[model samples]
Target chain A: MQELVEVRWHGRGGQGAKTAAQFLAEAALDAGKFIQAFPEYGPERAGAPIRTYTRISEKPINLHCGVVNPGYVVVIDPTLLSPAIVEGLSDQGILVVNTNEPIEAVRKKTNFQKGKVGVVDATQISLDTLGRPMPNMPMLGALLKVVPLVKLEDLYKNIKAKFLKKIGEEKTNANIAGIKKAYEQVRVG
Target chain B: MRKVVAMTGDQAAAEAMRQIEPDVVAAYPITPQTEIVMGFAQFVADGRVQTEMIPVESEHSAMSACVGAAASGARTMTATSANGLALMWEIVYIAASTRLPIVMPVVNRALSGPINIHCDHSDTMGARDSGWLQIYCENNQEVYENVIMAIRIAEHKDIRLPVMVCQDGFITSHAVEGIKLYDDKQVKEFIGAYQLEHSLLDIDKPVTYGPLDLQDFYFEHKRQQAEAIKNSLKAIPEIFAEFKKYFGSAYDFIDTYKLDDAELAIVALSSTAGTTKVVIDELRAQGKNVGLLRPRFFRPFPKEKIVRALSGLKAVAILDRSEAFSGQGGALFAEIRSALLDEPKRPLTVNYIYGLGGRDIDLQQIKSVYADLEKIVKAKKVKDLINYLGVR
Candidate 1:
C-alpha cells in the first residue's frame, strides 16, 4: 500500500481542467507510478463549473469513487475559488489556483485562510506564451511545483508526445513554454 | 511481453474487443458507454481489425442486429448503459433465450426518470432476470479481463448464452488507470476460433430462430435456458481457471477480503467492493473483525458459497446500489436473507441502499455501515433493517 496522493481540480467546462488532470496522471504513469484520473460527468456547458479528480500511487489504484478528501485542490477557474471547491480538502492539503492576484490577496478574497496556498498567473503566462488564455497546462505547471508528483521532465515529455502529432509543433512548443513560465513564476503563501 | 498501458474502463473494453476482433459489433452511442463503441469504431475506421462495425440508430436495434448476426454464426458483441440498456430490454431477453452467445459490456448506470447520468446498479439489476450471465468488475483491469473471460464463458459449448460484463459507469468507465494487456497472440490462442453447432447461415443444416411458441413448448425451452445458466455457474469458474493459467489472476464467482475469520462482513458488488476493501483494511488495523464479500457472479447468484461465507458472521450488511422498492429491502439484501433463512447460524442481516443515481459514498459512510453492523451485533436486534446511506 504505497502512499496515495489524491487531487481534485475545479474548473469550467472549457478550461481544460479535465485535460490537465489526465496529463498529470499520464505523466505519473510514465514516471513508473500508478495513477487514476477522471472527470465528473454531467450536462457540461462551456462555462459551467466542472470537477475532475486524479489519484497517484506507487501501488496500483483500486478505489473507484470520487475523491472526497483530496490531498490537493487545484482551481483552474479563478471564479471557482469558492468554499465549495475546497469543501473536502485535508488540513495539510495544498490549494493551488490560477490567478494574477497575489497569494495573500487571493486568500483574503476567498477567505480560504487555512491550507498552504500556491498561486500563479497561469492565464497571463498562457496569453504571453501560447497567445491564448488556456490555463490548463500552466496550472499543471503550478501543481507540479507544489507537489512534485512526477518529474518536470516527464511531464514535458508527455505533453510533447501527446500533442506533437495532434496539435503540431508550434502550439506544442508554446504550451510547453507556458508551462515552464508558470513553473518558474508560481508563488506559495 | 505483456503490454501495460493506462486506459479508462471504456477504452480497455474497446481494446479487449479490438484484440478479440469479433465478427460483428452493433452499438449505439450513450454517455459513459459511448466511448467504448467509439474507440472500437475508430479502430474499424483505421482498418486495424476486420470487425463488421454496425452503427445502429438505437440500443434496441443494436441488440437486434447482434441477435441476427449471432444467429448467422458470426461472433458478435455490443455495449450500452442506463437508458440504452432499457431500450434494448426486449432483445436483451431474446438474445439470452435464443442462446445467441453475444458478449456485451454493460457500463452500469442508473436508469433515468429524473434523467441523471452517473454510476449505479439499477440498469443491470433491472435485467438481472433476463437470463444473461452477469459479471461485476471492481476496476478497469477487471473490466478488460472480464470482457475477455465473458467471450469464453458465453460461448462455452454447454453455455451458449449472452454474457454482460458490468462495470460502474463513470467511476470505472471514464477513469483512467494502469492495466496490463495480454499480447494479441495469447488472447487469440486463449479464445481460439469461433464455432457454431447450428447456424442460420449453414445451407446444409436449415434452422429457424426466434420462432413463435405458445405455452406448451415455451416453458420447456425456458427451462433449458435456465439449465444453461445454471451450467454457466460451473462453466464460469472453469473458464476462470483457464484464464488464470494464461493471465495469472485468479478470479472466482465471489471475491473475499479478510473474511476467513470475521464476525462482521459486507456484501457488495462492482466498484463499491474496492472502496469496501480499503475500509476493511483501515478497520483491521484497529483490530475490528470486518471483512467483505464481493459477488462477481450476480446472475446465477452463487447461493451456496455466499451463505457459507456469511453463516458464521454475527452480523452482515448487504449494500445495494439500486433500490428494489419492495418496502422490505434492496435486491441483494433480499436474496442474501432468503439464502440464509434456513441456515442454523445465520447472521443478523441488514440492508443498505446507497449511492443511488451516482451519489458519492465516501470512507466515512463506509465506516458508518460497519459501525451499524457492530451495533446490530451488540444489541442482538436489527433496529432498522433497511437504511439509506449518504443521502440528505
Candidate 2:
C-alpha cells in the first residue's frame, strides 16, 4: 500500500509501552518486514508514564520522527484523556481505548470525532486472563483490529521478543486471545 | 573554501551527521529537532550515507537506543528539543558517564509552564549536570560546524564524553542562515572512519558495558568522566586547529568583537550574540568603543580566556535566558563571578535577563542592552536589577 499507517499507543510508566513496542517489533520480524518501535517518556518513575508506537512495512522504514499526528491512537489507560492527547489524533484516526465501556458510551464522554472509535473491555480481559488491569498486551490485540499498519503475525513476534521463553509463550497465547476478542468487539468504519 | 548556503540550524546539524555517516541514529523527533532526524533519514534512504536510523517512539527510547548503539561500538547520534530533551534527560547522564561518544543536537527552548514551542535555554540548562560536553552555537553555521566538531571531540582518545551541541530553538534551529557547506570529500577527510573499541558488538571479545558502579567505585567512575571533560578542554584547540586547516573558516573558545580598547562589553551566547554584535557595531560606529564577547564553548566556560579579555575592560554586562532563582543574577553571571574571583581587579559585571519564553528581542531592544552597559560602566559598580527585558 502506498498510504502510510501509524499507530499511537497510550500507557503509563512501567505499563509495558516499551514491552508492547518490543512485541510489535518482534511481530514485524515474524512477518518478514522491518519495523520501527519506541517510546515517549518523562522522568517517568512509577506513577508518571507516557506513549509508544510501531510501524511495520515490507520496505525499510524511512520515518525517523515521533507520531505527532497519527492515523490510529491506542489508549491503554482511561486516565490519559487529556486535551493534548485528544487533539493530536487525526480526523479519520481510529482510537482503541482500553476501558471496559462500550465504544458508544466513551464517545459520549469526549467530543472525539465519532466515526472511527474502537473501545474494548481490555481492562476486563486483562483482569480475566492475565489477572491484572495491564492492558498492554490486550491493547495490542485491540490495536491490530484498529491500526492497519501492523499484522497479527507481527504482534506474535512482538510478544516473543518481549517475554522471551516459557512465560513469554503463555503471555503470547494470552495476548493472541486478547487480540482475537478485541478484534471481534471493535467496529470499523 | 568559504561557501555560504542558507539553511536552518537543524538542517545544518543533519547535514553534518550526513557527512559523519554514523552507524546508528535513534531519535524521537520533537519540534525544532524534527527536521534534523528527518533530513538525516533522507540521507540514509538516499544511500548518500550508509547508516541505520532507529525510528524510536520517544526521546527516552531515542537516547536509550543511542546508548545501546554507542556501547556496541557504533557512532550514534540523536536530536531533540524542549519536552523531548526533558524526556531524554534521565538517559543523558548515562550516555555521558558510560563515556560513549553519542552526540545529541539540543534545540534549546523553554520548558512548558504555558506550553511554548519557541526558543530559550531552559531545556539545556536543565541538562547542565548531565555530564555531556555542552556547546552553544550562535547561528546555523556553528550548529553545522559544532555537530562535526562534537563527534571529533567526543571520540577523542583522551575524551570519550557525550556531547550536546545546543542551538536556539526557532531562532537558530528553524531560522534560515547562510552557511558554508563543505564538500563530501573534504568532510570525509576531516572526520575520519570511526574505530570501535571495547564495543559490545565486537563478537571476538564480547565485553559488557554499563556495569553498576557501587558506592566505592561510583565516585571514581564519575571522576573518570569528569577527567575526560577536563582533558577535552585541552584536546579541543588541537581538534579545532585541524578543523580550521581543513574547513578554512576557524573557530575559538570565545569570539570577542572589539573589546581591546573598549570601556564596556556585553557577554552572552546563542542568537543573542547576533543581537549584541549589531548593537555593539552601531555603538562603535557612533564613536562608542563597545565590544561583544560571545562564548562559543560553554563547558570549560573559557574562564581564563574571559578573565584575560574582560580584565582590560572597565565594565561588562551579562545576559541569561533563565532566572537563577539565587539572587539578582543569572547563572552565567554567577559562573563568571566564580571564574573571576582570583582576578586582581574584576570588572563591574552587571546582569540582565531578557528574551525569555520566546519573546522576540529585536535590534531596538538589543541596543537598549548596550545603553544599560554604558550606565553600568558609569556607575563603576555592578547593577543587579535581575531585569526581564522582553515581555510581560
Candidate 3:
C-alpha cells in the first residue's frame, strides 16, 4: 500500500455511496489508520449522481480538497459508468465496478486503458443475499479484493458491529455473506 | 483514556455538547449544521444528557431563547449556519451585550442570494464585530476541542461573552475523521459548574438586562463590553493553559506551520490552513522557503501574536474565504495589515480572496499563492493589493 490511499466512490443518491465511504473510513480507523471520508454535497435528490471520497493514511491526512487523482475509484452504479468516471486515474490505479458484465465488456464500456479493472455482479449478489439491489456492501467487498486497504476480517467485524443494531441480525448476516461472496467472485483484469 | 473515534465535525461538536451537557440548547436546524442539532437532539431523546432541547421555530427565536436562558443563569448552547445565522442577527448582538455566556457552533456557509449551502467564512465574518469571540477550527479535532473549550472561555468570570465556534460547513462539518475525545468526567470536571454571580432568576440580588439606555449610558455599556472582550486576550490564555494541563493538548490563538526560517508564508484560517500545510511541505522539498499562519481565534484578533509571527518574513499572502467587499481586501487581510502597521520590519503583505461560496482550495492553488508571494518579494512591491484566487 502507498503512504496515502485515496479512493473515490461514484454512485447515485440513496444508493448508500456516502455510507460506504464512511464505512471504509471507520473500518480503517478501527485498524489504527488515520482516515477521512466526505461526500461532494449539492442540491441533488435521490437517483442523482453523487460522489464521495475516502482517504486512509499511516500518518495524518491534511488535505481537505476533493480527491481528484484518486488511486482507486469505485463505481457502484453500472449505468453511471463513463470515461469521466475514470478521469485523473493513473495507469497503476485500480477501478472497481459493481456490474454483471465481464471484465472485457466493462473495459469496452468505460474505455478505461489506464489501471486494472475489477468487475462483480454486486446487484445479483445483493439480491440473492440481501433481498434487495443495494450494491454498496458488495462494492466494498470488491474494492477490498482489488486493493486491500484494510484487512478483510477487520472490515467484516466493523460492518457486522455497525449494522447488527440498526439493521437486524438476519439482514446483517446476509450483508456479510454478500460481501464474502463478492470478495471471492470479483473478476480483476 | 481518550477514546479514538471516527466522526464528522458536526458529530464531534455534538459529542462535546453531550459531554458538557449545558442547561439549555435552543436551536433550529440548518443544512450542514442540521446534523449537529440533530445529533444533540438524539442525545436528548436517549436521555444521555440533562439538557432542555428547545426545537425553536426560527433562528431568531433560537437566539432569543438562548439569551433568555443564559440570563436566567442557565448554561446555554446552540448551532446554526449562513442564513439561519443571518436570521439570528438581531439577537446575536443582544446576546453579546447582555453579557450572556452562550456558546454556538457556527458551521460557516455562504450567505445566499442564489441559495447556496456550502463552506465559506462569509457567515461568521459577517458577525465578526458582534462582540462574540470567534474561534475557527482546522479539522474535526479542533472543532471538538474548540467547542469544549469555548464553554469555559465564555463562562469565565472575567470574560462573560458569547462565543462562536466556527468550522467550515460541509468541509469539516460533513467530513468524517478520527478524533480523540477525552473522558466525560474529565470534561465535566474541566468545565466545572456554571457560576453566575447575579442572575435574572436570582431574586435575592436581581439585575436588569437589556434595558433602554439611549444616550445616557449606552456608550458606557458598549465600552464595558469592549473591555470584557479585550480581557479575553488575557483570560483565554489562562483557560487554555488549564485545558492543556487537563486534556494533555496544547492550544494557542494562532498555529504557525514551518514559519521559523521561511521567507514567504500564507496566512489563512480553518481547513484551508491544513491544505496550505501540504503545499508548504511540497514547496519546502523543492527548496522553496514557504510557510502557513492559521489563526484559531478571529474575534480577539490576536494582533500582537500575528505581527510577531510574520515579523521577519520577506513577504506573506493572506487568504480569506469570504470577500469582505471592502474594495481594498478581505476582513483578515485588513485586520492583519492594520496589526502590522506599527511593526518596522513587517513582511510585505497582499490579500488573496479564495474559496468563496465553498469553492475547493486545492494544493496547486495554494502553491500558486506561494509562487505569487515569491514574485512579490522579488519585485519588493505588490501589483494588486486584492486578488481573487481560483475564480474564472
Predicted model with the maximum lDDT: 3
True contacts kept of each: 0.87, 0.00, 0.87
* Residue range B1-392, candidate 2, lDDT tens digits: 54544456788999999988889999887876889989998888889988888899998999999999999888889988899988888898889888889888898888887887777887887777788888998877788999998888889999888888998876667544446788877887888878877978788898878887799799988888778878877999999999989887688888888888888888887878766775676788899989888888777567878888888677777888876678757778788867877888777777778767767676666677778777877776655656777656
Candidate 3 RMSD computed on C-alpha atoms after optimal superposition onto the true structure = 0.8
Point out where model 3 deviates above 4 Å.
Answer: none
Candidate scoring better on TM-score of 1 and 2: 1
Clashing residue pairs in all predictions, respectively, total 0, 11, 0
Q: Pairs clashing in candidate 3? A: none
Question: What is candidate 2's lDDT per residue for A1-189, written digit by digit as tens?
Answer: 333455667788877776676466556545555555555534547657577766555654333334567777777888776545665676667777877666666576656755488778777787777776777877777777766446776566555655567576776677667767776776554
lDDT of 1 by residue, A41-72 (tens): 87879999999998999886767667888999
Q: Over 4 Å off in model 1, which ranges?
A: none
For each candidate in the order shown, give its overall lDDT on alpha carbons: 0.91, 0.76, 0.93
The DockQ-based order of candidates, best leading, equals 3, 1, 2
> CA shift at B261, candidate 3, in angstroms?
0.7
Greater TM-score among 2 and 3 belongs to 3
* Model 2 stretches with alpha carbons more than 4 Å out: A1-189, B1-3
Clashing pairs in 1: none
Question: Which of the two, 1 or 3, has more DockQ?
Answer: 3
**If the candidates were sorted by their lDDT against the true structure, best first, what order would they fall in?**
3, 1, 2
